[model samples]
Target: MYSLLQRLRSLRHGFWYGVSRRIRWSRGAFEEAPARELCNVDPEPAERIAALRDRYQVQFELGMSAATSRNNYEYLDLLDRGWSSLGIGRPSGGVLCDIGCASFWYAATLQAFFQPDRLLGVEVEGHRLFRDGRARIDYAAGYLWRLPNAEFVVADYTRCLLPADLITCWFAFLTPAAILAWRLPLSLLAPERLFPRIRHNLRPVGLFFMVNHGPAEAALAEGLCAAAGLRRAGRWSSPAALSRYRMLPSVLSWWRAG
Candidate 1:
């Protein structure tokens, strides 16, 4: 009975995935504008928040809702702390690619943190709750419309990618259990292929940054990077506080392409 139920769920998800792709293609060009009202700030120390704002020039507002705004701020904080701890400095104008960027919740934070001349968010899944309603791609594009250099693409990272000066993958699914939990097709779980592609697309000396759920996943990811011949740059366990929710402390790691 359990096997049968799992099969049924997979079929349902597969059917919807095909339908969503067709709908997305038929929708014509996607158009978006900057969110009208950008008003939400983190309640961190005044000086710290101000310093971040001054450095990144990011307001950390999604303009979608207060909840999303707050979430963005939290991500911004995480990125700042993680990158600083790793001894990675902000990059000048260059290309950046973020893999597994579902809904691109941190699109603004990434744009501000890296200050990339071109920011591309790549995701394999573009599922929608309803056929006619908005999809994950819609949310990403809308949220990033304010940043002229930021764009999102629905594609498999293992199959295709543009060369980039910097690459980031946040909480990528490393185990089969993680993929099933997200209801993604099992075929999409291809760390072996994904890591190689990431290394190939990274320009020489370019940075590849990743964040994992905890020490276990971090170890798995580190091994993959090593197999791909990426030189380990730095690793740190983020200690930033995410007051909105509870979870295991995140582990951050970065590698440089030879």
Candidate 2:
């Protein structure tokens, strides 16, 4: 949806473009932002599930080692906005947090698309330029903690949301093969506990996306969701560009249950 040049320009100077007090806006955003908040994650069914990440590592995207992400609406948004970055977490309402949100490409995209609403992205590293004038996207750069106006928080797959409309995990899971390493080079030592956390974090029929890891990865992820009691809404596939680190070609999974 965006040419390379335009995307680059947007990235380099999106803050600049937004600097003018005369920033433009989409009429629908005011309506959509609030409505979307109603969809926050909940319903996976667990009263006391311990956190799964089990490790206090740096958030991936904002810096260098970010988790996987989509190349469709996300990529297209950045493409259109003229920026190149790690599109970390999902867009949720009501204290949203993209657990494991890396660079927060999605927040940037929302700023580009919606152009008005405030989006606070919590990461291990902060990245907000207030002078840019684009409603200063919040960057709670540090280990995840419950914060005000911070609807999201990055965590391990087994982590659950306090309460949110959406939870985006863009292929941020163990690989089929690497699933055996079980050390720092990997992610965590306890693999068995993670699935339960993923299941616990879901908001009943909340939405989560996975672009490509392979049929096996999809099936395993689906099974984990089912065990967590989340029903499958459907799966979708479409042509989109992926990050250099992205290995998937199409987003082949989706879910919703209430």
Candidate 3:
């Protein structure tokens, strides 16, 4: 019943949050943003899973959301915001780091979509998610082998140092703070330290983009942004705009180097 209670709490949160943020929703926001492309990969899960196995020589599973992502325009829509929000016009071969990049899907997908100079996906699990840590790393490395420019590392961001021209964090709060509180609360409470690291590593005038799903989450993110001394670039609070990008009560905030 602990699980049931959790689900109930989640449902309640979604209901209240949706009602409170209803004013921001609009279909027009989606219409106004740049167009998005649908997923081009085969619809069959077996086919896709097989492809990963053959390429990486490991048995890996993709979350239902990410597996079906390409079939719809949602993923591309999110990427559209990532690109437009950061003001990345063309590929200048800049470095991009995705924090808490689990399963390496965002890192891999965005790498293919944006073709940046280099892409770094940092996760705490490393390769241990699979049979052993090596398999996971091998899977990530092998998957991006052709890309050559993209690399994956298993490490905690708060304890480690990482630099990038563009840094992104998406839906990280989905993971319960309790699970992360002991290991690295800074990532949850105050990621100000990461701000300086990004500033130090990012190219001139680099960008940091953060998305949080609800008011509560946005509050935490804002605190981190302030602690990091990040200058707000822009925000998308409109309901339609947030929904179009699959963000919840979402605050799409970006920061530029001061």
The candidate maximizing lDDT is 1
- lDDT per residue as tens, model 2, 53-156: 11212122332212211222344432322221223333334323344455354543333332323344433212223443222223222221222233333333
Specify the poorest-scoring 10-residue window by lDDT in model 2: 45-54
Model 1 poorest 10 in a row by lDDT: 25-34
Q: What is the C-alpha lDDT of each candidate?
A: 0.75, 0.37, 0.54
Give one digit per residue, the lDDT tens place, for model 1 in 137-221: 6677667777888888889899985899999998899886687678765667789999999999999868898888879889999
Off by over 4 Å in 3: 1-68, 71-73, 81-91, 130-135, 173-192, 238-249
Q: Is candidate 2 or candidate 3 better by TM-score?
A: 3
Better of 1 and 3 by TM-score: 1
Question: Against the hidden true structure, what lDDT does model 3 obtain?
Answer: 0.54
Estimated TM-score for each candidate:
0.84, 0.44, 0.58
Better of 2 and 3 by lDDT: 3
**Best-to-worst ranking by lDDT:** 1, 3, 2
Identify the leading candidate in terms of TM-score: 1
Off by over 4 Å in 2: 1-95, 110-161, 176-184, 187-192, 241-247
After superposition, which runs of candidate 1 have C-alpha atoms over 4 Å from their true positions?
A: 1-8, 25-51, 130-132
